[model samples]
Target: MRVLVCDDEQLARDRLKRLVEKADNVEVVAEAANGREAIEQTQEHRPDVVLMDIRMPEMDGMEAAEHLSKIDNPPAIIFCTAYDEHALQAFKVHAVDYLLKPVSLSDLEMALSKARTLNRVQLAELGKEVSEEKPRRRGHISARTHRGLELVPVDEVRYFLADQKYVTVCFSEGEVLIDETLKDLETEFGEQFVRIHRNALVALRYIEGMELATAGHHQVRLRGIEERLTVSRRHVAGLRKVLQSL
Candidate 1:
């Protein structure tokens, strides 16, 4: 199996490369020094598997994996990191396996076996052409309003504001405060919404444009909505890119 090894440390990459070469069925096809390079290499080499390091400069492995997994024919990812804290999150993203640092040849073999099995399963699923089905629109967003347990539809939503604990779903007709977090909503309705801040996720269709305000702050102007949304500095570039693509 073709494999790509990614790590910020040159020594770590070299060590992993030797270990991968020692594997009977594994071929070390390429190597990357960071997450950005890993993405680029994955596109170019189309390796069957990638040995990813969790933390790196420019982009973290989790973020890179999220983007890479969305590619047409993404390689199976096997996270090789020293930190064990991210094992659960790694598995949540459908990683083949998580191998701790100083990974033994036996551990590498086990990960490889799992990756091959997963690749076969994914290919089989892809071979069967599933009929295109329309996704059902959310009829109501369960929220705590004055009446409690209020159901709000898509049209009624103006924008979603994120607070410390809860996300306030504002509507033209009436606002409803939901107990859900912004990250949870992002996963549920990523196609219909855009994350304008780490704390906020807003409906894409309602966004009119963004304006540069004082102190280099950015504000999102929503169509038919009176409240202007704040865009965090980290998300400004991404929001601008999404708007330009629209």
Candidate 2:
């Protein structure tokens, strides 16, 4: 099996490479120093399995795995982290197996043999669990592009529109669809954005003013965006209260 090693430390990467070389039926195909490079190498080499470190400089394993899950026929992911076993129960809940740091050869073989491919739903769940545990929300949002993963800084995003299961993030450059719920996003970015409608969250910084859509309905006008989103009757009251506060 082709395997990719992703860790921030050079020593960790070297040790993982040696162990993977000794393992039967597995070869070290690529190595990455951070989660961003992991995504790049994973795309280039198309390894059968990826040994991902949970914490890294640019991105973490959970975020990388979320991006990797979008790839067509994505590789199996085995998170290798120094996090305590009990703390990693969330990963196990979603059926994504993990190995503790200082990985044992036997554990590596077993993880490779039983590594399960993560579907979009499971990946979404994994992201949710990670978000719930994090003390601060992620500074950037990741979306799948035609080439690879795209990172949109939370500050650059102007608004978010919910479409069924996906949230379309409208940013300074353009918009990209992501597998995150509107409610979850509102909770995470509540300080920066306000819920304008049940299906949309508008950034407070972009708010120009409100316009009347019809007799009683209202619409919010953003700075650069010409198109305005409807303010549902149910949400109008809360939106007014928020606007007054602002």
Candidate 3:
């Protein structure tokens, strides 16, 4: 079994590496100092399991695990933390097990052996619901492209158009289909984007002007995108006000 060890402390990571070496059939594939790096390494290495540290800087293990869970196949997670209280709470999500800091070799082996599959996506959802602190809003989304995970900066995003289950994320480079809902995108990026229609949330930066469409209909013309989004009757006034402010 391949494993990626993630911890902020160098000593902690080194100790875990030495201990992991003793376990039969287990190979340490990568090491990450923080949750963001952990997510990147997991994608690059495709490790079977991640020894995740909960209290990490930039992105906590819970949030990183949540993002990683969005992929086609996420690794089983075994949370390794200094806190014991987390054991009671963390299992509710997708984590296969939690190991207290200064983990015994036997416990590590047992945890690895017991893991049939990584924690479920529901586990990550539960983490979001419980925490008092919301996960840091990502400046870029990891959009899966034909080239793999493409990090699309939020600043470059032109608009998000909803079509049934998927939302097409239009950026400066191009557009990509994502599984995210329009409502969720609105909540997350409300400051940057405003609702122009029931089906669309457009970036304020991309709004060049509005033009009158056929028979009293209104359309928003974005800077670079060729598509002219129809402005819903209910939202036209609000869109005008937002544009007027800028």
Residues 77-116, model 1: lDDT tens digits: 8999999999987765667789999999999999998888
TM-score: model 1 vs. ground truth: 0.54
Each prediction's TM-score versus the true structure: 0.54, 0.74, 0.73
- Order by TM-score, highest first: 2, 3, 1
Question: Pick by lDDT: which candidate is best?
Answer: 3
Stretches off by above 4 angstroms in model 2 are 85-96, 116-145, 163-166, 179-181, 187-191, 208-237, 244-246
C-alpha lDDT of residue 105 in model 1? 91
Tell me how candidate 1 scores on lDDT.
0.76
Candidate 3 TM-score, true structure as reference: 0.73
Residue 234 in candidate 1, Cα distance off native in Å: 26
Model 2 residue 136 CA deviation in Å: 9.8
Taken over the whole model, the C-alpha lDDT of each candidate is 0.76, 0.79, 0.81
Which pairs of residues collide in candidate 3? Answer: 76-118, 93-123, 94-119, 94-120, 94-123
Candidate 2, TM-score vs. the true structure?
0.74
Model with the higher lDDT, candidate 1 or 2: 2
